[model samples]
Target: DQQVKQNSPSLSVQEGRISILNCDYTNSMFDYFLWYKKYPAEGPTFLISISSIKDKNEDGRFTVFLNKSAKHLSLHIVPSQPGDSAVYFCAASHGGYQKVTFGTGTKLQVIP
Candidate 1:
């Protein structure tokens, strides 16, 4: 069984709008969650992260929220721009372990 899941395969948003990506996990042991954005022909780059202890974390236009009780998480991008178009992966890890599980990924298209 897949521990991490991204229900939506893709999302579209107009420029300067908001983009929301959702994720779910079956593993309750996960205490750390992260979001990664990947561009074509390049590796995924870390975007934002949240520990189980925190409900939300934000940086600039990017924000991540985690609901430990529900085993769900989401990534929000405000004022989405054309450059923000990419495949976003939701990842989770436990404690100090470096091993992480990643979701299938959601492709976001920011149309201008």
Candidate 2:
């Protein structure tokens, strides 16, 4: 079974709005959570991440929040722009980033 899951396969958001991507995990052993943005014909680039010890982490327009008790996490992008459109993947790993399990991915489209 997939340990990490992204229930929504895709999302659409208007430009200058907020885009929220959600992910869920079944394995509690995961201590670290990460989000990646992938463009067509390119590798996924690390966006933002949060440690299990922290509830939230923010960088510029991107913010990641972890709810360990609920085994849930979310990525929020404020003032979404067209360039922000990409497939976002949620990943989890334990024991210092040895092996990571990735979700199916959520495609985000920001309408201009």
- Estimate, for each residue in 1-112, the C-alpha lDDT of model 2 and write its tens digit: 9999999999999999999999999999999999999998999899998999999999999999999889999999998999999999999999774787999999999999
Please give the range of 10 consecutive residues that has the lowest summed lDDT in model 1. Answer: 92-101
TM-scores of the candidates are 0.97, 0.98
- Per-residue CA lDDT of candidate 1, range 4-49, in tens? 9999999999999999999999999888999999998999899999
Model 1 residue runs over 4 Å out of place are none
Model 2, runs deviating above 4 Å: none
Model number with the top TM-score: 2
Model 2 backbone overlap count: 0
The CA lDDT at 39 in model 2 is: 96
> Whole-model Cα lDDT per candidate?
0.94, 0.96
